[model samples]
Target: MMMKKGFLLKQILWISALIFMFGCGSEEQFEQTASGLEYKFHIKNDSARPVQLYDIVEVRMNYGTHDSVLFASGNQTIPFQIDPIYEGDLLEGIMLMHLGDSATFVIDTEDFFVKMMQSPQIPDYADGEDKLYFDLKVVNIITETPAVKARRLEATERKLAEEKTIADYVEENNITVAPTESGLYFIPITEGNGSKVKNGDAVKVHYTGSLLDGTVYYSSFDRGMPITFVAGSGEMLAGWEEAILMMKPGGKARWIVPSSLAYGSYEREGVKAYSPLIFDVELIEIVD
Candidate 1:
């Protein structure tokens, strides 16, 4: 009887160990889609509606390899129409999610690398064997209509006109400053010492921004604090971003930004719609 009791206790312990292992493994399991993409939802709102074709959806996405973050949208949400049917494992996973859903998708890096190689330059982090991951949240969905399309087209046309105005101004004034590849025009007043600013470096800048007619809109000097942000992070205007990357610490420059690169068609408190902007900027330091 004593031997039989000991044997039963051993059997129970073995079964418990098996159950524990299976539970731990299951925690990491993700649902695989027909396209072979694997995904798991971290947050789901079943009551929220799923986006349909022709709907404009806003999403925040972070895409990278398992070990590193290559790119992120930060606090900004990108809006896109769902009509074109984008081809990718990430898009496929996104289609499965409803509004307010947050999910992580795992895609085969081999396929991604193949598509990326079609570009002129392959990124340094591209690895064929590594799995790419996308963490995305569907923020909102708007049904597109004819009015929305018309308004967008109108905005585009206005923006083009504003760009032409800036070009004409540059020509008439004989501004000898040339534009960068990204279309930012800058005149370096004083060359700063030290290393040139690069992407991903946190930098401090003192700037005074105004309209083309020399109407001052904002000045960092008035605030008594220099503005600091990660370079090339889209936290500032596109023209400012391009100019800052070209400067070193203590460099002073004047940037003439077209409407498209400045504020587009959006009018802020002191900025008018379709207005070209000028900024007198001084790079204070490269924090990192």
Candidate 2:
């Protein structure tokens, strides 16, 4: 009986040892440290296109340090500004680091803005939130660095400067409008009894606009109706807002818009930089 009891105890010890080993091996270990940041990646395509260097990516990241237990949480879909450090060409950073390798790089927001401005790429503010960091790793890659982050900043700055010059040229050349403090000029054609335009009025008016060189930029005659906009709101440019105020339902007039009141210094597809603009506008109807 003594030998039998000793054998049963040995069998129980062996079973427990096996169970312990199995538990440890099953636990998943990450090659990248959470470090307090999480990148929630969504694949739009299972066999997705290769990630480019300058291509804007939509990533969901928890922008905080790993050491903090309580973190600020929010969702962001912003463009990733790829610089030259990645050598202007690479298939994907993750493929270079391997499928599971991860790393973090802390970037300064103010400095980022200054750098972007230096290139003159005036980025439009989607909502005006400032400063962000990017944490990335290669998931898959078929190529290595060689693609260049194109220089669009200088072109953007040139466009903005040109628009401003256009506005200034109109003003300096005796373009003739009764100016207001809000950077608008009004020239009235018809004297009507009704209010110029109401807050909720569905106003319509035909309009034709041209550059200083007699190049017609836009014309409502082609569109088949007058342009409509809400008054006292940002629906129209500064010049348009001021011009409409001087019109009645059937009034016709002209407006010389400065670059400040138009597209600023930014160049449009066909519109060159710093070109002054002219508009011969007509108010046809106001549907209240």
Candidate 3:
């Protein structure tokens, strides 16, 4: 009986070991082999241009066993965040990964991209359909964290501040405003046409927005028209709705927006946060 029990214990131990190995294998997307590197990648370049080496590239790259294919490659921009691109090989960004790292992806290229890049030069394979395969390796990588994160952050703040100064200059010379409790200021540009721009009314305006330093962030002028948004019902920002309420139809005015009225100081991926902004706005139409 003891011998039989011992044999059962051995079988159970082996099964547990196999499960552990399989779990570990399914962790990262790609793995390495004798032939080179191997993995599938997600394709996201929907534009009619080829993916550039100067851009950050990320894929589900793996270089190991069969079970390692667990997660689909999440977004990984190559050239690592610290090392800004400066006109060299775009592939240099991901070249810093280790031997076992892998990326899986699907490549999407546009017709013009194929013509411009003559992409046939790279090592890739087609899988019987529209899909192409990419198996890459880090022959090497630029393993330095170029900027201490804090300093880089400060530099970005300084740039935004500079942009704001320009917007401030525009505001200083043009309009008059008074601050209110809602963190938005009011200026009586024109008299009303009876309806107060309360919640639910659709409002349209032509606007050009910039930092105080004068870098334009958004503009309805791009479309050569005004944009429409619902008011107090909340399709617009708090500051915008408040400012519009002060103006009547046909009113043209400039608004100096505080950070609390804009996207606040939260740093967006590529844009600085907490930026004081200015907008030259014309209330062209208000729809019910």
Candidate 4:
């Protein structure tokens, strides 16, 4: 009987060992940095060249809580210059990876939360026990020279000034408008009479887009043809899509689009980098 009891105990111990080796021990696959950041390589390309400080790198990233994806840059990669002076685990992990490498970074929730406190999109239910995970792929690396760096810095400064101008205009005008969660502000000029515009609907609109100082950049009237496009098709700026969806046929409204929702830091045609745009738009019709 004692022998049988001993045999049963050994069997239990063996099963527990197997479970630990195959399941809970999976965390051991990840390597820890000196700062306690953990990362595991999903794909490693040892032959690919690595990047140095100040090198511009294009990376595709998906970031979220362990259980849910909050944001993802699908297909479109983001370009950023590596700044060794910047302090963050994400940057630290990225610096360790080479082009063509894909890795998952695990960051402490408390640290991530503190860093992300300024962003309103963070869910209220987030807790310190939870971890933030980032899946990153280094796509491309570009060497930055002194002239290129100077140009980039000038553009960045211009963008910051433009944003400040927009904020000052908003305050001085005492503009009372409905602000979207994404920083767009809409002031209804005239309510529409028909159904509200929705995603997948074909809509025609006449618009006059201008800078915050009321400098007209583009006008559909000047082209003599109203612009027509599928709503929410991503064919237009993010601010335009958000505002159009709220309007009905025959609606007229003024929209204040922040630069982040507009051309970002890119200068396109008449729009400059970080320009907050003002649009006076009339939703003429909604077809389909």
Every candidate's CA RMSD: 15.6, 20.5, 19.9, 15.4
Tell me the whole-model lDDT of each prediction, alpha carbons only: 0.65, 0.43, 0.43, 0.68
lDDT of 3 at 266: 33
The candidate scoring highest on TM-score is: 4
Listed per model in order, the count of residue pairs whose N, CA or C atoms clash below 3 Å is: 0, 27, 44, 0
Off by over 4 Å in 4: 1-49, 57-94, 97-142, 158-163, 171-174, 178-181, 215-217, 233-235, 265-267
TM-score of 2: 0.43
lDDT of 4 at 34: 79
Over 1-288, each residue of candidate 1 has an lDDT whose tens digit, in order, gives 101112211211110101111112342577887667788787798889997765778887776665566556666665665532235545567678899888777766655433321111223455443676667788888888898677556655766687677788789878998787757798889999999999889998888888877788888878887888777554455566677888999999998877656654444557755677888899999995
Lowest summed lDDT across 10 adjacent residues in model 1 is found at 12-21
Colliding residue pairs in candidate 4: none
Global CA lDDT of candidate 1, please? 0.65
Who is ahead in TM-score, 1 or 3? Answer: 1
lDDT of 4: 0.68
For model 1, the stretches where C-alpha displacement exceeds 4 angstroms are 1-132, 135-140, 144-151, 191-203, 210-217, 229-241, 248-250, 258-277, 285-288
Worst 10 residues of 3 by lDDT: 11-20
Winner by TM-score between candidate 3 and candidate 2: 2
Considering every candidate listed, which one attains the maximal lDDT? 4
Instruction: Return the lDDT, model 1, position 84.
Output: 26
| Cα lDDT of model 3 by residue, 1-288, tens digit | 101112211211110101112223342554443323333322222332333322223333221123332112223222322232222211332333342243332233221112212221121221123322223332222322445456456646755674455345547766455457644545455554656566557778888877666787677888686777666542344467567777767777777766555544333333365556677787777875
